[model samples]
Target: MASLRRVFATSILASVLSQVLTATAQPAFGVCYGMLGDNLPTPAAAIQLYKNHNIGTMQLYDPNPEALQALGNSGISVILGTKNEDLPNLASSVEAAKSWIDAHVLPYQGVNIKYIAVGDEVIPGESAQCVLPAMQNLQSAISGSSFSSVAMTTAVSGTVLGASYPPSSGAFTGDAKRALSGILQFLSNTHAPLLINVYPYFAYAADPSNIRLDYALFTAPGPVVRDGDLSYWNLLDAMVDAYYAAMERENFPNVGVVISESGWPSAGNGNFTTPQLALTYNRNFMKKIVAGTGTPKRPDSHLDGNIFAMFNEDLKSAGEEQNFGLFYPDGTPVYPIFS
Candidate 1:
């Protein structure tokens, strides 16, 4: 009897420990490492900063050679992007895609490349025509390589949605719908998630009259928007669900959605972009991702996403674009995000 009691106690303790470890492990949340700043740290130091904060993933805006080299054997997952200018060539021939992978990706065998974003916010424009072909060619190229497991996709802005007021009524704009039809189908067939840059800050900044700040910041006291049986407490989930609904409408319901970029600016806007609000939104966003919370539309889905940026970019367009970093150029935490 004594031996059985001891075994039971040990089992209980192990279970509790497992739960604690699971709760603390936040592999789903990541930060986008933007290199528009001339004063940013070296690739090695930037990688170290991510490690110091326990950020397990990174979203690189391009296949930066130095960043890739630094990421080797670092155990950090990466979402590598391709330059928009290269899209025409990548779409024109499969050989160009293979060459790109050979030049940029194959050299870094130790880097854990998760997704290869073909372009950033290029859809519904001239580059939109090149996106699908580039993705297809890249997919073919990747399939023949060791990094075949890497998902190939592109990131798009929330402006693609023509109707998103009610989550259920979400549908893509005519141009965006036309462009995404093939892309969405490809995503469904390949099991790759669509990378979306969902910025609630932009939405709120655009229309503060109807959109409450608490709803956008995930601090709503209760359900702010009731879409039938689904209640939205925050704008992030609503925006994400809108994309899901739009995809469902487009007949690609199985294709997943990954938020490639989302963050609040710390300055450059009056009364809207402040450090405290940025900290609150990011902290709450990280909590949601860490908890593996899903939206009401997809209750069982795990929300995998990257925060907008790692450090403020001085060279980006003036104003809020330059102020989205969680850290300053010197690698100090702008706010206690990891804390």
Candidate 2:
């Protein structure tokens, strides 16, 4: 009797330990590592920067070999991307997809690669045709390989949706609908989340007269918008819920949504792009993610978000594009983001 009791207690302790380890393994938030700049730090130094800030995941704009080498054995999750131009080639030939994966993915044996994003915002017009085929081929390639556990999907722009204001009224229209529907089907089949780049800054910058700065920064004085029974305190939550509503409208309510890119520019041509505003937005955004409170529409679900950039890209032509990074090229943070 005593031996059986001891065995039962050991089983309970093992179960509890497993739960704790699983929770610890999951990252609360991550940052985007855009290597579009001329003076960004080397991969090794950049990895240390992420470690210093406690960023447990990284979304790279491409499967950079140097970056992969630095990330190996670091335990940071990676979401590597394939350039849009490569999509057509990859879509046309499964062998090409396998070759690309073998060259880029198989070589990084020790890196914690979590997902492979096919292309960025390619679900529109001519490029839309390549999205699913590339994803399918890539999925097949991964399934046959040792890296089958890595999720596959593409990143889309929030501009793909129509009538996103009321959240509940959101829908994909015209070409976007056809393109997104097929992509949604692929995601459903593979059990991969739909990654969307949601930037409230763009909306607010386009129409400052109607959009409150505090609301856009997630520091609203009160709930600024109401959709059906849901009250949204900030623009981020509304934007996220808008995607959820759009997915539900397409009969894909179970498909998960992950924010592939989101960040406030520290400097731009307008008053809304001040460093203080950027700091406030990113800090609050991180807090919201860490708190594990999902958007009003998907309150029970945890939303994974990646901040737009690690370093400001000096080479970007657009003023705002060069200003999105949380850090400067020399490894100095543009502002205090983490506690």
Please provide, for model 2 over 228-323, each residue's C-alpha lDDT reduced to its tens digit, 9 standing for 90 to 100: 789999999999888888999999998998888989998876787986678777766766766677998889998888898899998887888899
lDDT of 1 by residue, 224-272 (tens): 9999999999999999999999999988889899989999998999889
Alpha-carbon runs more than 4 Å astray in model 1: 1-23
Clash total of candidate 1: 0
TM-score (all chains, Cα) for each model: 0.92, 0.91
The candidate that wins on TM-score is 1
